[model samples]
Target chain A: MATKKPKIRTMEELASAIAVSRPTLSRFFQDPESVRPATAEKIRQGLAHVDYVPNFFATRMNRRASGLVGVIVPLLTDPFFASLLQTVELAALEMDFTVITQCSHGSAELEANAVERLLSMNTEGVVVAPLGEYGSADALRQLGRSLPIVFVDSRPAEPYTTIDFVGTDNEQSIGLITDYLCRTGAPPVYLGMPRLNSNGLERESAYRRWMAGHDLRPEVLPDDLAPQSWAFETYAYQTMDALFGQGLYVDATILCANDRLAMGALQAAHRHGLFNSRPGARTRVRIAGHDDHPLSRFMTPALTTVAQDIDTIGMTAMSLLASRIRSGKPGEETVERTFPAALKIRESA
Target chain B: MATKKPKIRTMEELASAIAVSRPTLSRFFQDPESVRPATAEKIRQGLAHVDYVPNFFATRMNRRASGLVGVIVPLLTDPFFASLLQTVELAALEMDFTVITQCSHGSAELEANAVERLLSMNTEGVVVAPLGEYGSADALRQLGRSLPIVFVDSRPAEPYTTIDFVGTDNEQSIGLITDYLCRTGAPPVYLGMPRLNSNGLERESAYRRWMAGHDLRPEVLPDDLAPQSWAFETYAYQTMDALFGQGLYVDATILCANDRLAMGALQAAHRHGLFNSRPGARTRVRIAGHDDHPLSRFMTPALTTVAQDIDTIGMTAMSLLASRIRSGKPGEETVERTFPAALKIRESA
Candidate 1:
């Protein structure tokens, strides 16, 4: 026969068994700070004696801060955004903050809707990686009027407002990648979008200029997908396949628009059965991209990409937004802080 | 020279262009239903004529419901949870509801905190995938007392008076997997935690019983990591590697505890080069698991997993909770709804 475990009846019985009060026990559950240190100790001892465990949700209401920080991203399926958002969540946990995340699916209306919902909650503040499209800008500007909203990844063109901007220097960052590719080998095909308001426009322009400076002809792919519908792999895979069918010739190297697109390029290359490393590394086709997403390391042969400083971005954005929340006055100084990106040399390139 | 686009100022100017009053224009943006049919048309024309867009947050404020539904999960780093939560968000959007997602990190305190925050926002309701061990049952129950709270994936022993629940049929679903493995191949080595919650315990028990019924001895490799740590992959990888190194060979198949752990096992098997398919029609060391996570399809050779009926579960839970919300009464029946799991036969057994 199995031994039966005894059950606890009341707080008093449990307290008496360990040797502490009903009030103190309640206080400990409600707010840990509400009870005296000595009383808390006695209650802890009593709890062990009776083996009484309080209910899960009940103890939470007994505490404070609600532990929720609202996080809004452009999309969740995008590995780049997912990696950065995961980092922010980890940082929030370290600060004892629970994160409530939402993806706008690149819709300005949805972004605003997500924000309004977050505001309804007892969110300390919001860390938003917004879509730089015109609609989202206006929506963000409106949100800036109320809460301590921190803008991440996307940079709003309005230079007068003091919304904290934490992101990489897209132009300079991509320029470095372009320069390296041009210097090490023949200039690779530049894969990017064709939009003016897009922050990536700066990167594309930088690549063109860098190529021209090196006296190399630039081959830019034209893409018209809306920012909301733009997926890295889908674009890259189709475009690369098209390039292959068109009998486009390459110098055994490719520079992708982003890490996701690069991953797609790798898959395309693999489909062509071109993965063997030649003696002296001559037969290896080099592929590189930007934003070293967390999963980049796990990809086949890994990825040689540029890494963004998201830690500094998240922390600075939060602190800046917190100050604005406390001031009650909208900020005037537009401090556009840009974190430098570094090249990560891996198996791919 | 490029033609310059004209910009108009003031709502009245835009309204006049489309033959509408400023008040109607304002009302249209606030709530499209507030105006007459003709008036709404005129206002939309006014908006399009000058491209005048109203503030989303301010406009939504005029509505009765915020259209915000809170979604709380344990963490975002786990791809499986990330994918599940993403699906929930899509479903909520299809119902014209915005989602606010919070991560509990499998902590009871954090779960409670997220609930309090959601309440402070006066959210319509919350769908939570809680950490069963985290002592959040009471906090959730308290919320259930006043608000619509739906439990997803995890359920407390003591059901909430008003809260609704949606989850997979752990016992029956896992039993199906165990039965299949036992019939077709040698009883697999049970790899998982010694003591587990609903899903884990159900899968473990099914394995044990299936082995016993088939007149075979069960080999258990219980993980030593604490449940709260949320380190499923690390431990599974290390354990599988250790077993492989020790020359521990049993049946021709490996049954993983879950899809996530199965993913780790697959990676380990690949690393050791023992997971290759045979040339003939013979099954090559079958590997099967539960939970058809999103990544399961994309894996090399795919995966043979148990598919949970996510759509039915989500919709049922929402409808049940919504009824409770409308009636202003707690649900009478404690519904323990269990959906069957279907086997997805892929390359990996």
Candidate 2:
């Protein structure tokens, strides 16, 4: 016996059967709120009858803007950025915006290209974590004039008066951690990144200022030995290994730039037979870091760090961008907001 | 003196300046290969003279297909998926394809929504790490009929003959790690997840099979203790802590389903004063895991794990999808490719 094949329905037929114009049907699928409730209901009912799915490309062609937002980050593999992205995604979804995230892989060129791509898409807005020193100011400025942009985590070195910025209070966070490290143990030497982003520079300055305020000598590991790549753990591991090999900073506290660096230092200390306990005979080194990475708690001795309120950051950035998108004004005065960080003391320090 | 405003050029002006149609200019921005070399070069020179970026939405409206490929994963915060995503993105870029990645957050509904969004974007193809048992087969089947799909890490429960799949050889990997653990120390207790994905189920089965082959009783951790959330580390930490409080397996080795769980177990052991070294008086617990997460090497004892060849998986998946897209055949026979996992023996075991 022969079986009958299912009938295929075209989008035009579906729209006609639903008794609505093609543009209205397209608008309904793009966003239900776009079409009138009665027409949207008719389209929905018709959609259930036919196995036809609207072609997104064709629907987007009719619309002036796709209800899409672009989020560009310096790196996605970093737990800090990963957590931040998650928070932002949830927030964007709640605001009825679809987010398309892209990673720059720590390259300035890639960052610029990402912006260009987002611009091409006619994205409603963009939330970016700029590659501080390496980012292109001209490209950002040009793009900023065309759409709403919110800079998160770190702002561009050459600030544009029209761009919104959201980030943690790095100076205050660093001061809090440094004060704790000094009071609980020996004064710490600053181990910092190679100025990859503005946050590192702020933290380094804060560490120096705090040490000098306490009438102590300021010590920072030189940048000559810093790794040129974004693998901060490897850089910290090698730096600590070389420093330990020279019998430097034994029984001294070290304030790492971030949790990943602190993790590597802890590993280096463990390999050197140095215990990381606070009150033990085997204890040899004290360590603290900034940016309470998600995995910090799982570290062997746990880690002492400053926790950035990522939820607040994500919420603030989204709110600012949504407002800008609604206003659609490019000449508005820029707003910069900073959330304070909290200290999380654990066994490491 | 007031600054002189820069002249704004439109797509029409640029096209006329380059002596080409607007459609050709749009095609050049979408993909350079779509236009003849000489015309593309002429358009590039015209673009260099003007500070204009093509409207991607408008350009996409004219094209039959967007050069965008969708990549969907069960979770984005997990380092395993992050690593796999990085590999896939780089490979896709090499193939001149733009990648749009979305995370399902381990929810089948979210997975279906993600596929719907991709369909709306008119994505050329999709590489998905499905949500396993919870995923909607009907939604995937509908998407499969429209474009090529390559499943990564795990395949769907209701298999379709036209879809391609690429993943790690779970049985071989688990067997290799289990044999090493048994040979080196006490036969390890199996620590498994709540069967969120097929990988966990396969690892659990492989552990039981190996134990039976050795004529030993297999011990699998009960799933009742597993957390309902995707936080594997917390789940493992709580499970290990509870078992330790009961004085169960005080000195026995453990084989975790994945590295995140192993990390949690390691942290719990440290809290209980059980060291993780091969040749030390303080050594008490020996633990191993699978899927060598990026941070696993930075662990104090350096995790011993089965390293899934994520690069191979990404490359194979992309290659298969690209070929399928080129062929444009939904009725073609499915292809299944498995890359062998390597046992990385480190200090933990």
Candidate 3:
């Protein structure tokens, strides 16, 4: 019969068994350098006799800062966020930092929990694309005070005193697309989500401002009529289907807030026998969107949209955070960086 | 003017100033529980006078394991992986575990590097969707020896002893779709990636077996002619274009390896003026795919494909990992779990 080994429950027990003081054993766990060489060797031998695994969370609390960087995105299911995360991870790796990503699933409570967890782990810094209007502003503000944080893609509903931000020039991008639509065809009606985040609000505002300047009426799907989910494609599809049934936008062009919405709306149009064609082909409907997502080009009649400089945004945010981390300064002035978005002309528009 | 304060450089200096032994000061830094309450208070007060951020990565070396659970996927930009990641993350959260995801970017070197980093972090466990034949099998096998690892989606080319796996039943799924396609139209030709991973190879083999059972010729894109990149959509699009240019399969229906590839092929067909309709309709061709990706339903004419039970796969992988972790037995017999796939008949086929 095999003999059973004894289970050591705590570090204190193991320390006592080795005839070393508990503090000396604890010191060995923190860093072998902190303890004398002979004492460290004894602790190592003591560990060999027992199955003891230290509580990592509790260990983290005693440490100052980890090399880990936390990245929080609103939704991992969104290709935009997915692409952005890939870029951020690659950049972090280049700078010798390992990134850990968390998805909020578009909930304030979950976002708060993610932040709390990151803080508890003693993360050195964070790059977050916040949940915006739906996020817990208080938790984020509190976190900003303790660690180096850089906000990307969308800013928070409530501003932080010294947090840096990196994002696309949504106003310019939306206005440029709107102007092109007007010049080539009928002014496009805006179709988008509710005020979910700063990006959504800014894009809507930019569309309204551009339409007003061009003397064109701005039409949008009312809040009550829009779908109430983070699944933008499904929402756009359902919204467009309902609109088509009601004979709304019979001869109008539509500009979606993002490429996902456009994909869904385009599918709805195709299902309704509205084949997309070139600008002068007298197609039933003309559709365009922002954010030239990866699949946008693969869509039938290819989607015409604006492409944000995702690489630049990710690199800039990382560079800014790296400076802050190196300087060990959390009291630096806020820096705002914006990358330009370019128009991608394809078959749809 | 603010007075210049003396900088306490090392832990030894702070220990002397606080009237505590250096080992006791280190003990407080490891875990407060290791030192007496009185000694911990003195160390805390001493820390107030200095800006000392301990090197956390070095400290982690002394600990046995971290609270972190690693999730490795082939690519983050793929919506299929994104959705799977979301499901796994939610499940992990339900079990009170936080997940950190890493993308391998479809490179074996990067995959190896990711596994190495996760091991260095002393992660509790890992759920990985490997890059099939392209992954670093040795690295994964080495990792399996130290931790509880559950392979999800695509398995590694070289199997390790006692490694658990959870995935979709690709053989049954391919046969079901192929039978449906054959009954509805002409025998579909196999369009897919090179044998990059088990999923691709298994799918291709299944397609061949199904075709052979029906006394039909097996048709696949020659290996030398296939695209080399992991961008499946681009590969499909380019392959279809090149094939069309060569005047191959003028009236034949295409059975794509996955939805992403099908989307690309469909786009290529559309560009080539081959609008897909019902099998008997007067359209240029029909196309069907597997793995009903999220965007497949929103495609023009929607996609005809098979839906893998992603939720079940994710949930099962997590559950299996949780059990292995609780048991603390890395030498357990290997377990393989496969979930059935359902055929979703849409307009394309």
Fnat for candidate 1 (0 to 1): 0.11
Candidate 1's residue-wise lDDT over B84-128, tens digit each? 676777777777776767777667787787777676544667887
* Comparison by lDDT, 1 against 3, better one: 3
Sort order, TM-score high to low: 2, 3, 1
CAPRI tier of model 1: incorrect
Q: Which stretches of candidate 2 lie over 4 Å from their true place?
A: A1-44, A61-64, A223-225, A276-283, B1-46, B223-225, B276-283
lDDT of 3 by residue, B30-106 (tens): 67789988878777887776644443433344555345688999899888889889999999999877787888888
Q: Could you give the interface RMSD of candidate 1 in angstroms?
A: 8.2
What is every candidate's C-alpha DockQ against the true complex, given to 2 decimals? 0.10, 0.69, 0.30
Query: Candidate 1, overall lDDT?
Result: 0.66
- What ranking emerges by lDDT with the best candidate at the front? 2, 3, 1
Scored by TM-score, the top model is 2
State in Å the error of residue A193, model 3: 1.6
Instruction: Report the error of model 1 at residue A106, Å.
Output: 2.6
Q: Each prediction's Cα lDDT score?
A: 0.66, 0.82, 0.81
Clashes by residue pair, model 2: A56-B120, A120-B56
RMSD vs true structure, all candidates: 10.0, 3.7, 7.3
Report the lDDT tens digits of candidate 1 across residue range A1-349.
Answer: 1343344545566555655556666668777678888777777665554534453223443233434567788777665566677678767766766676778877777877776666544455688887766665655664565456777887554543366677888877887887777677766777774242345666777788878887888877654542434556666766676665554533367877678777766766655445644345444567788888655544555678888887777766666655654575545665667888998877777
lDDT of 3 by residue, A233-307 (tens): 888888888887787775678999999999988988887767744365454688998999998998876899999
